[model samples]
Target: MADTPPPAMPTLADLQHWTWLLGRAQQMMIEQGFDAMRARDPVLPAIPGLTDPETLARTRDFWTDSLTLWQRLLIPQAEPVVETPAQARDKRFKDPRWRENPLFDWIRQSYFLFSDQMLAQVEAVQGVDDKQREQMRFAARGFLDAVSPSNFPATNPEVLEKTLETGGQNLLKGLQNMLADLAKGQLTHTDSTAFEVGRNLAMTPGKVVHRTDLYELIQYAPATENVLATPLVIFPPWINRFYILDLTPEKSFIRWAVEQGITVFLVSWRSADASMKDVVWDDYIAAQIEAIELIRAGLDVPAVHTIGYCVAGTTLAATLAILAARGEADTVKSATFFTAQVDFKNAGELLHFVADDQLALLKTLTTDGFLDGRYMASVFNQLRGRDLIWNYVTNNYLLGKDYAPFDLLHWNGDTTNLPATWHLRYLLDLYRDNLLVEPGALSALGVPIDLGRVETPAYIQAGREDHIAPPESVWVMTRHFKGETRFVLAGSGHIAGVVNPPSAGKYQYWRNADSVSSLAEFIAGAVETKGSWWPDWIAWLRDHGAETVAATGPRQPGEGSLPVLDDAPGRYVRAR
Candidate 1:
């Protein structure tokens, strides 16, 4: 018998044409599914302006834009017939092919036009409350972002080109990567193998001086000849690993603080599991108090300077309030808050997930005693879906590209679960009820906590672009405090803004000497200083009462009254 004829390999044009058809089919199915869902249960509930004349006008405008876009596509105009307000700045359409190729250009423009109209409609709905409006906007954006042409294999020019170049091998590899990520139960944002907790990432030299079921305290070996008489303790957010502040030598805030004649201690909160199901807010507060007492006893210091980031900062405020109730506010000589919000009135996008209905749903899901860290991580990723979620979806799943080693992303992906009791109380008290700002409205460790009575000198830093904790929200914290407060605004988002080191010289920070009633007022009067805010913060610490003393060595296990457990970036932080 004659040998079977070999199959012909598809050409680039053939593949492109077929893929375009496939992409259109996929898009049509998606649209049909969305329409059906909307029909069954509308995306937005009945609000005052939803079906009013203004909504009718918006519908007309949307149709007008759609018709104009179709006309432009047929006529091949040099200029776009319709434009979105965000079209110029949208990074998703940055590829030249998105503009040069007529089909892709139309797709990109049409997507933006629809997205803009949907968002505008959401905004125009007048009767809905702020929270509802925000929820609608967030949902609209999420759907629009998910359907962006750049995310699909067939529509994305870069992905298509890569597929053609590799003769479908890219798609095969991408499938494999997707499967691996699915197995892991979370998306891979960076090369996980490139970094390790103790090796390259959290390499700051220290020893775990104290350990509890709640946390491990790491006392860093002094880096200077003379260290501050008053030690500094850092309470990083337990939502993620504590290594964010100790990523690498260049980026490690712990190392930098130790080098600057400050004895540094950091709390690495244990990642909650089913075993920690009953851990509540008071337990965390107690843990912080315990750490403070341990530091005082170990270092022989009367009081310690304390720093807290994110949720930890909120807890620290509560702890301070409790201490004030006990007449022990002086235990913390100075308090520094990094992107922490004591007031959630304008807490930003995070509030979207803390709505009453959402909380009820979350409670049901956390019947296992805790909310999985991956769930929280996914929530955060969805907040910046275009970058953190879809961007990786395209690179790792569509284009079959490997992620570059990003210490920040690696740390971000290393999440920690929230104990069910602690999680619900936090969301209810701080986010849903906004009770933290109300004097004696909240209590912890059996004390009626009032932030107003906590007179500890405070240094509060807020990120200008922090979506998690808006600058306004952080600014409102100053109003709750009775003591002298200095508010400094940093240049970037939550992580970069707080983790910024002086050596990198990346982003700028703003500082104002005079107190301001609002964030806007602070910005108007503030001076824009180049470089990181770390030095300015250090200087503030020194002024707050940090006297120099002989630097001490790392207190190994059994060497002191506060027994050391293991090493820096201890087991609590290393737990999965």
Candidate 2:
């Protein structure tokens, strides 16, 4: 009997040729998809004499630079022919081989040139409305990002090297990974099996004090002997799970607040299904009011401080308005909004998906009664395509690398379904029509909602780089509130800015005592402070009536008026 020899390893040239073929096939598929989309919705209107002199000049410049690059390739020089843009912070082209190898360098430079030219052309379209132009720009950027050289195997030096080093095993593993992700119907941004809802991610000690069709209210066990008399009730956005605030003991804002002598109660929203299709925005507001009543009844407190993150914050603002109209504004002694937007005038890139055509498409897709969680997740991922989508695609599919276990990313991937009626009302009323900020423009629970009439002291926090709720959009919220408002700008984007704890001391926040009319004016007067804004927020709460009292542990079934339903990070959070 003779032993068989192992297959020969592929040469670099062979691998490159194979990758080129794969790239071409992928390009053809992408082009076909784009063509179909354009056929349905033309990106730019055919306006007569729309092309200005600047557009012609930009076209000429693109050709000139492209020709110069070709010339550089033909005639080799000692020094590099072109340098990457100084302001360019893309990590994709960080490999040494990208600059060291003339071929890869040219590919990188050429891609950037094309991206700039395409974006410039989109910007130069003059006759289109602002929203249309913005949509065109977004589409062009998405296309450019999709076709980046770094996304392909042949053009990316690191992927090619890994493929060669592993003798094409990486490609086989990558195929397996892609198939697994496709079956799951979502991209694996982190090691999904590394953490669980109650096991590690949302391990804060608590008991589910109350449960409703809409949410489960978890009352965290007090960490300090003496706690604030007024408890803190948090309403996290229903678009995702609530564990984002309770990710880990270290990163858990819920745990940190408990340790800081604050009795915290957080609402874990139910993941909507077909049965919940009849749920409306008013139901959510009613659920919030119900949670507040439950907290007050169980703890026997007259009022509580409240916090809302993202979309829930918008609802909370409405809740405040409803309370004010009913002469019950004092129920929420103080309100803190975390990266929440009340105005959508400059709502950023997410606005591109809220137009009539896109909404109509969404309506058709949601015939199943609820919008699939994956749909919203895909939209968010597209907002930062390079970081969220392509980065994972390159690692999981191209390089065959598994992502690290990150609690934040784990929480991010745990998406929740949105009821069709509630989601549509939110998009149309709040985002499209910008009615939330306008006094008495919206109503819930049969009360005319007027944000200006709510005089509860507010601590509004905005992420300086937030895309979902632009800081400018958030800043506009300060103007709507007639109460004593303190606007704090935190460093980093939405999730990072809000989940930041004092112990980590990673990013900085800014505060200004002086009044300001606009985001720009606020920034000009604001003073920078190091570390997390949690402590400052705590101080604000204390100043605005968060008095300390003897702390208590999680309540047992017979211990309080509200029965203990379950342990911390309850079943609602565990829902798929």
Candidate 3:
């Protein structure tokens, strides 16, 4: 029977089986997710009209538009042409004509402007939905929960009974006003530029130092005298603002390290301009290399410790690898990455955006200009849109919840533009190509990023609750480094994890070669810790610090009382 024609592969029965199985599986997943959420918060039952008829059509339309854009305009443009030679494809990104694309530029501009308009429209709508409003409604419901009702007068039986008689009419009015305030504050921007004046807090009093030239070094003594000997230089991502690390006097990591006697210098990257648009990834690494040299020259230190945070972390690893390949590893003592991804093999949901098609579209958009901050923010917002983005929508717009103004949120909303050139290069070379992980994949600024060549002792940190950089994906650092390395899983999301103050209550789970059998096992046994991760890190640095030298004279920049900026966390970042 001709071996029954070898039987048809992927037969009709197989196809039908797969179709039914897939349908059932999808249904199960959806039910499971809903069940989990409802179980955790009984208030979820209030969403009985989740699919209200009035909003149903609008919601469907929104998804349809979104899916269409995703598949056609967005997806095709962002996808990477991996099968082709990366070097040749990379060259296409260099053409002057590519930067002039209108669609690319329009979307970048429209993303931010449109986002602003949409948010405003939603805010104008008073009665959106009731049940959805409670999603973000934070208040004390009982005495035993996170918050106590006794703290509020209404919790008392006498007051509660009286309030009930009035049908809570007075309470409702106050709630309306409070909710309005939250809605407005959610997208509020403030001008704090005045705060960028030269003022340094002191036990005594001293002239403040302000170093402006990108090449100039700011010299200040960290309060501690017995600090770590490894010359520590910090590289902060320039995406938002520089002061995230030095947020407040009490929470500043720079201040903390200084008090611990660790020599620390942080890079305050200039907000890039049109001129900087011509600058590529190579220039960035080159700048870092130059900074290292300058720091070494001034300190006369044999080697230095390098710390990179978020995007800066990946930048640091890339620079170290390039330097190492050039036989300059001796200049580097150690390296630490805070929530940075060097291994892109599993870039998580983020990869969905930078996938070949979306990136190609973004490339077209950014051809003539920088990736508008609004566009970038929108992409990130979409990642957890239902929670971070939409939950706020329900509370602020629908329920009129009021949020007290917070410096952190204020800074977060203050967006920064990205140079179109640098943004494209980052996407093409790092995100989509996965060059940093692949040997010789990316040759940035004429130097290849050889992770195996990065011989500096490394400490890598990933956050357990980080949606931006998940633990499983970020832990890839364990396999990439060629030198002595330790990987840590921190407690919070990307921003909270880093800014975690000693007062912050959370414990991180992690595994090290010396302590645990494997990263998975360690994570499984992880326990909660009280207080910030900063103290533990300070202790780590102390153990690594070289013997303290006689307190050296303050290394002021010039004779005329070295010019001081308003303060360490000054105006450059405080700009609205």
Candidate 4:
């Protein structure tokens, strides 16, 4: 047995295999080095001699002329300049006594000596005899000089002006904050009112009579109080907190919808955690079903209208398809999506960060335990770094300007962590693999997601200038959905696109009067309306709203056997 174990010695073939492996490893190392170098600083200069091959060979030969002399004799004789004991002692360290220690002295000396020895091995690429060396030196100097701190735009007058502009913006932000605080202080008048508002905002105002592992619903007594004819269920993406639609009175979309004689229930998706990791597309659909069941049971309603935004829009679409496949069409009557993508074939360039390598890194991070909220925020920040991050940084940090606290910015910074399991599945399945678009590429709860089966009328809205989710990305849904769909191209970016109030200044939106028009032809003939699109959207949604009915009974404090698990506006804000 011992003789047999020692039988495999390194033959020429084995040696060759080792050589190949070493070469491959070296190549990968070189590639990685190149990546780091390019990322750090990329410099390209005109090489007059290298412009032509004939001259390039001559230039190369000239530079290497001193190679033999330098490499064989001068290089071998090169010695490091040593520091005296006094000089070494003068070097600052928190633990000065350690410098006198033998180990520390030897380690520092060895490091310098080793660095000098390594430096001596390379023959200088410049030479005295080389006429082309002059150009090479010029280019090298230009490149090196360009990277120096002095070369930065801080020294330039125009750059100084831009810097001042950045400073002014920050000051403006600070002033804005002061005003907001003053306004809030004046409006509140008392801590009691402020507390009430904060308490209202911190928790959901509705109660969850029905519950699932993923989502819950807060049901309110029908404000219409008539026999409830239609039940409306609002679906919002969990990417942000669920309170955007329920912000407060006047601006609160949910409040407005309820006040307009509609029986509305908003879906409160629980923030993901380890337990919810494996939750995929199917779980969301099931949650929607459960939510609808609970809503119907409480309201004693027949069907429900669904409104979904961003990720939840697609989720609702999938739910509609799932219900249709199960022949449960009576559950949902109409659907609306705001800035959600169903077709992602041309989702755009920002998705490059979510490509294989980055996705793999992200998935690996999530695998540990939780998807760091700040990490996800940083990735999102990169999509519009120039506008969202750098512009502010240059103004607030570099320009030494005071910044006002913006409510939106404060809210934006309040990112939520993703459950690692769901995040990985989301990136791999929806983004990189684009399972949503590919036929049978992805499934939820063992059910295939076929957009063609979504026959419910859809009202889709998208922003024209949204770098995060471009208008072209939204159009992808039109190509796939087999429904009577109206796609509206709205003005502004993702946030402004969705929250564009009627009073928003100088708003513009495009609408295709005929919902059946192909996206291409619709783009050709779409009419642009001045002012905010919210008025038109609200009017359109109103027409589709559930008809008036008799008043429903009061929301029972403890309906059936389920008591209110938590107060309205539960601990969602505390998440992450």
Compared with the true structure, what per-residue lDDT tens digits does model 4 show for residues 1-576? Answer: 455555667764565455556655665674565556657766543234332333444433332332322222223333332465644553222234323433343334443333333223222342344433433443343333333221234432323455587755644554454465356431111122232323444332456555566666666444445533676788888777767666544445666566556666777777676676666666777788887877667656677888888888878877877777778867777788888887665565445656567777886777745676767667666565444554444344334344554434444555666667666777667766678876666677667778788788778889888766778888778777787777889888777677655544566899988654356777788999986776776577666653666553433435533457655554554455
* Tens digit per residue, CA lDDT, model 3, 1-576: 355556557754465456556655665675566667778986754342342333333444443333333333333454322222532343212333322443332232233233433433343344655422321121111111212222233322333443577676545754665455466443322223422322322111122244443323344465654445556778888786666666556656666666666666666666655556676777667777877876676666677788888888888888988888888898987787888998776666666666567877887766556666766766666565544454443334323345554556555665666788888778777777787888788787777778888778887788888878777767877678788777777777888888876754556544444545455876777655565767666556555555665335433222233355544444454343
Model 2 RMSD in Å is 8.5
Ranking of all predicted structures according to TM-score, beginning with the best and ending with the worst: 2, 1, 4, 3
Regions of candidate 2 where Cα sits further than 4 Å from its true position? 1-52, 76-88, 553-558
Candidate 1 per-residue lDDT, tens place, 1-576, comes to 999999998764565456556655655674565456669987644335544547656755665566556555655653575455568778877889988887788888888877778788788866688778888988998998899989998898988999999998888988999999899899899998988999899898888877878888888877677887888899999998998999988999988988888888899999999999999989988988999998888767789999999999999999999998898888899999999989898888988888778888898889989999988988899989999988888888888887799999999888899999889888888898899888878777778888888799999999989989988899888999999899999999899999899989889999888867777888999999999999999999999886677774333234567766787778988887
Q: What local lDDT does model 4 show for residue 230?
A: 71
Report model 2's TM-score to 2 decimal places.
0.89
- List residue ranges in candidate 1 displaced over 4 A: 1-53, 81-85, 553-559
**Candidate 1 versus the native: TM-score?**
0.89
TM-score of each: 0.89, 0.89, 0.63, 0.64
Q: What is the C-alpha lDDT of each candidate?
A: 0.85, 0.85, 0.59, 0.60
lDDT of 2 by residue, 99-211 (tens): 77778877887888888788877877667998888889889988988998888998899999999999988888888999998998998899888998878888888888788
Listed per model in order, the count of residue pairs whose N, CA or C atoms clash below 3 Å is 0, 0, 41, 12
The positional error of residue 530 in candidate 4, measured at the CA in angstroms, is: 2.8
Better of 2 and 4 by lDDT: 2
